[model samples]
Target: MTKIPAISLRRLSKSFGDLDVLGVMDLDVGRGEFVSILGPSGCGKSTLLSILSGIEEATTGEITIHGAPLNQSGQPFAWMPQNDALLPWRTVVDNVGLGYQVAGRLSKRAARDQARLLLPAFGLEEFSRALPYQLSGGMRQRVALARTIAQGRDMLLLDEPFGALDAITRTELQLWLEQIWGVDRPTVILITHDVREAVLLSDRIYVFSDRPAQIVAEFEVPLDRPRTIEMLAGAQATQLELDLLRALHVGSGDTP
Candidate 1:
């Protein structure tokens, strides 16, 4: 069966002032599938994301989510940025619920009640009363994911949510994120500079070229579901990673 695409981009293109930032990009994301966009810096990965999230406009293209066009203001989708963006003064529980509070969508009591419900899942029930400053980096990212998950949106646009973590923490969180997303099955488009990280998590990866970014290659990740670091040593995963590194070389300029 042809799975319904959660997001569809047809002939997408974008430009900044006089410079072309993205051009004639085409993409499709099936419902509940996790896809990653990998590329070098200045390839408009962020710009493309801005358009997908409706944070920025598309110069020429179409974006459809669940078969409907996305209007400005980026509704029906939640975006988690590279930074957790938590307020230090707020309690962990309070920070998670801040989304509803700022939107005036729920009363403080209701919001906290809802946010409190997620504490156990992220393993932060004990730290609910603590402030952001009191939590470790991994814990802070948990709070960020908890906040995004709390929104109950069907699509998640994750822009290097784990990039700032140390190697050990990053690997641990990769497993954690895979568990959550696999269980919930929300359509996800992750943007990351770490090619290895992208290889470990995505169903498929879209490789982009520089400045006027466009898709140069797309590779299907053949590693089976519930992926683990142990697979990191497996032949299939290694081959896919090598192929992706090669894909980045398709464009002009320095690439590794």
Candidate 2:
């Protein structure tokens, strides 16, 4: 039996006045699959995500989630942007529970209670009362992630969630995220600039072209999971990375 895709995009396009950001693009993400959109800085990756999340409208397209048209009531996706975007005045617990409160699905106290229970899993139990100003960048992102997870959505749209972090911290968080996603198996669509990050974290990767962005190539990562950074050191991984790099270079109108 074929499983219907968790999300689908057909003839999706976005424009800003005379400038086009995303050309007519078609994509699909299967249930429980980790997919990545790998592209350059301004290739409209975030724009596509915004459209999926209903933060922005597409100029022309058909978007479906779980076989239903977009905006059909219960949200099929949750979004995590490039920045942590935690509230400065809110404590860690409060920040992590804001989603539930905002949804009116739970009271603030109930939301905090839920956040408190989940904080230990995120390694944030000790800092429940800490303000955003008191936490490191990595910790703040953890709180943000906890908030996103608190929503219990089955699909996640991550726009370079670890893009702003340092190398070591990013690696640590990526491992932690992979572990969490492995357990939950939420369908994920991640937008990223790092080739290795996409290869490491995704089941399949779509490399996008320059402006008026569209998928130029796609590759499946054949490695089995519970994947670690150490696996990326092998010959196959190196060649795959080189291939992705070449695709990006070629997509940008440069000879690889």
Candidate 3:
């Protein structure tokens, strides 16, 4: 039996006036699969994400979710962006629960109640009262994840969610994300250029071309479950890295 994709992009194109960003791209994210869009700086990775999220409208093509059109809702599913973007005025608990607060889906107490229990799981038990400014860059992102998770979004669109953190902290959070997201795995579409990060985290990766990007290649990481940083540091990681490098070579106009 074939599982219907969580999100499908069929010949999708996007442009800003004369500048074309994405050109008739087709992408498939399977149900509960963790997929990453890997490409270069100016290749419109974020633009593609924005178009899919309906934050930026596409010039043509279709983005459908579970047989329904996302054009109707404009913004459906959950979004966790490149920046932590935690509100300065809100404390950790309030920040994590902030989405519910804005949507009026849950009262203040109830939202915080959920955030409080989930905080320690995110290594944020001690900082519930702390403001965003009081925490490190990495700590702030944990709050961001906590907030995103609080929404319990079924399809998560993550744009470099851990891009800003230090190496050690980033590794810590990566493991945390795998654990949390592993349970009740949501259909995830991540935009990242970090090859190892993409390889370590994703089930499959979609590589793109220059400017008006195309799906140059797709590679399934054969690495088994319970993955760790150590796995990425070994020979298997070396081979996977080369595979990713070759796929992304298309982004640089490297013909293979």
Quick one: best TM-score, which candidate? 2
Error of 3 at 224 (Å): 1.2
TM-score of each: 0.94, 0.97, 0.93
The CA lDDT of each predicted structure is 0.85, 0.89, 0.83
Clash counts for all predictions? 0, 0, 0
Stretches of candidate 2 off by over 4 Å are none
Query: Model 2 over residues 1-256: C-alpha lDDT tens digits?
Result: 3877889898999999999999899999999999999998999999999998889999998998888899784777788878888999999999999877775389999999888998999999999999999999899889888888887788888989889999999999998998888888889999999998988899999999999898999999977798899889988788889999999998888784
Model 2, position 231: C-alpha lDDT score:
85
Candidate 1 lDDT over residue span 1-256, tens digit each: 4765788899989987899999798899988789999988767888877877778999998888777787743586788877899988899999898766654378878989988988898889999999998899999999999888877777888988888999999998999998888887888999887888998899989998877988888988989889888987899988988888888876535654
RMSD values for the candidates in order, in angstroms, are: 1.9, 1.2, 1.9
Order candidates by lDDT, high to low: 2, 1, 3
Better structure of 1 and 2 per lDDT: 2
For candidate 1, give the lDDT. Answer: 0.85
- Lowest lDDT sum, 10 consecutive residues, model 2, at 96-105
